[model samples]
Target: MIADTELILNADGSIYHLNLKPEDLAHTIILVGDPERVPIVSKYFDTIEVRKGKREFITHTGMLRGKRLSVLSTGIGTDNIDIVLNEIDALINVDFTTKVLREDLRSVDIIRIGTSGSIQGNIPVGTLLASEFAVGFDTLMQFYVKSYTAAEQKLAEAVNRHFSNLSFSPYIGSANPALLKQFAMELPKGITMTAPGFYGPQGRSVRTHNMYPDLIQKANSFITKEGLYITNLEMETAGIYALSNMFGHRALSINAILASRLHEEFCANPAEVIDSAIQYVLNRI
Candidate 1:
């Protein structure tokens, strides 16, 4: 049995951080990085039945296309992804009252519709790209025990070699094959690089300077032995993929390219681009 300290619950028995009970969750979930984006996606729902919020985690459960769905905000970064994914998994796969794992495991479909910046010059702003694979530059995977496939192993080795100048080794994670094929089969697909932060980790400069001045250039030039190149940079896809796979859930990230580091371009109408991506995902669901 899990300890109370380990599986902390609120007075009302909802998950500690998400403030969502098992009944409030839907099997199909959409994750956004901003809490405000939760309503943006839920707006298209035929009817909203549950609306819950705690800190940056906001959840909306409703029906769309005669199917039940829930959209939640995970705030930003892999750190937040770690918290949100683990808690939600526990909500589904564990018997909260008993504080034990359920006899039968359950799985959920998680789709991340978030914005990203293209590292490659060809992938321009405003394009909706699906992440087939994501390489995490963050340390979230260090604490988790993950077994990689031969393809993932090869990609990880290639990325490590290409970015040899970096202090730490990077980990590669991929979208669930079934989910990728269902929603993003026809979309442009690429490997996404998940950075830990927005400014220095993503090669952005404002008030502070980055240690690796050529981080973006290196990421742009990186290519795997199989000829896959890193296409875009974001903060959460890698963590989402890794944790979702670990928890026996399906996950996919659909990105709206809001900025281009290669061409130094930013999307003029980001709201339109995000709405388009949201509609694209909603229609498929």
Candidate 2:
């Protein structure tokens, strides 16, 4: 089943979207939201094999502690994730040049190191959070053919009720369990509350009238029966987690805390916080 765009490429032997080629990548991939931040994370690399950028997507392939890795920018949202994820999967699992599904598909470990705000006051700025779960609040899931079980449906219904009462839609998502067992001990672990944005979507104070004033409280207090708390708030975790899980890939999110929604103050120096997060994940992964 070859798609029309079999070999996604640029004129100079670079990838189409990422502007990179096979030799320019490594098995371990780290995804970041901002393209400018790609080099910041890759700076710690022992040796940089390649560097390429296309539009909002930037990639740096190198070695860190002798672990071959690719640091790529997935831009700001889940929409960008769809392109990068599919292409990376095609490169690793499907053999893009030939457009053939490899008999033995190689699974690349993906880690998202991003900045986020804390819904729970306990998680203050400058702390790094690892998402054990992600509650999706985006449109990426509608693309997939879904068949939710009765139990799953009930949970979704409850989530809907909670959102409807508050007049905001909360996406239900979770991180890769395999990743949790691997690096859970390294960072402060909790379920990440994946939000759609930093504005009114997350109950941020903009120029317009916003929804529930107790949005963060509602999120923090609404715990699943098994005891899952909404710990962090970011844009793409739910989409990344959901899609990666559906495709049989492992994914984890390590968030550098920038603000506390409860306290309403962003970290004075977010650069140091994000830097610390990168080092932590690099060492752990």
Candidate 3:
């Protein structure tokens, strides 16, 4: 049984951060980074059932084409993902009222539909890409004991060697292959780099100076001995992949290219691009 201090609940007994209960979610879930995008995905539902919100977390449960699913927003970076993923896992696998682990574990399918910037010029703006692997530049995984597989270790080593000058090391996480096989048809598969922030971490310079000015270019050119290179840059996929894997859930990240770092281009119709990707995911699921 988890202590109250560890698994905090609201006055109504909902998860503290997500404000979700066991009955509020579905077996299959779709996660978006923006709260507004929650409705964008749920709008395709044939019948809507649950709609709840608190803070940046928003959840909508509904049926589409007779398939029941839940859409929830994680809101921006891995920091938020840390709260969302654990709470959702607790909702399903833990007996919240008793604060005890259930005999039977439940694994949910988590798909992140997000917009990203292509690190490689060839990926092109407005294109949809599925993450085969997610490289995390954030320190989220460091807080937990090691959970990386052998393949992830090799990838992390290669990334570390490539960027030896950096003070911190990056970790690598892979997407669920079953989910990837189901949805990756006609979608280009590439490794995604999940930055801690949209600014300096992603090599964007504003009022503050960038520690790695050539970060984007270096990331673009980095190729492992296995011949894998980064395809896109986003702020959430690595955390989603890592946490979902840790909690025994299947996860995938489908990206809509809104910007191109190599070409210095941004999508003219970003909303339409995201809408198209959402529809594509809806059709596949």
C-alpha TM-score for every candidate: 0.99, 0.89, 0.98
Q: In model 3, which range of ten residues has the least summed lDDT?
A: 144-153
Model 1 C-alpha lDDT per residue in residues 151-238, reported as the tens digit of each score: 8889988998889888998898899999999899889999999999999998888998789989999998888656799999999999
- Model 2 over residues 1-285: C-alpha lDDT tens digits? 566566566677565787776667787899999988999999999999888888898899988887899999998877888788877776677655665788997777889999998888788889988887777776777778645444445556666766677444444556666777776675788777666666776876768777666677787776667665678788888888777766667898989999987888889999999998888888886
* Over 4 Å off, model 2: 5-8, 12-14, 146-158, 166-171, 211-214
> Looking at candidate 1, what is the lDDT of residue 214?
94
Candidate 1 residue-pair clash tally: 0
lDDT of 1 at 176: 95
- After superposition, candidate 1 runs with Cα above 4 Å error: none
Highest lDDT, which number? Answer: 1
Candidate structures ordered by TM-score, highest first: 1, 3, 2
List RMSD in Å for every model shown: 0.8, 2.6, 0.9
Query: What TM-score quantifies how close candidate 2 is to the native fold?
Result: 0.89
The number of clashing residue pairs in each candidate reads 0, 7, 0
**After TM-score superposition, what is the CA distance of residue 168 in candidate 2 from its true location, in Å?**
8.5
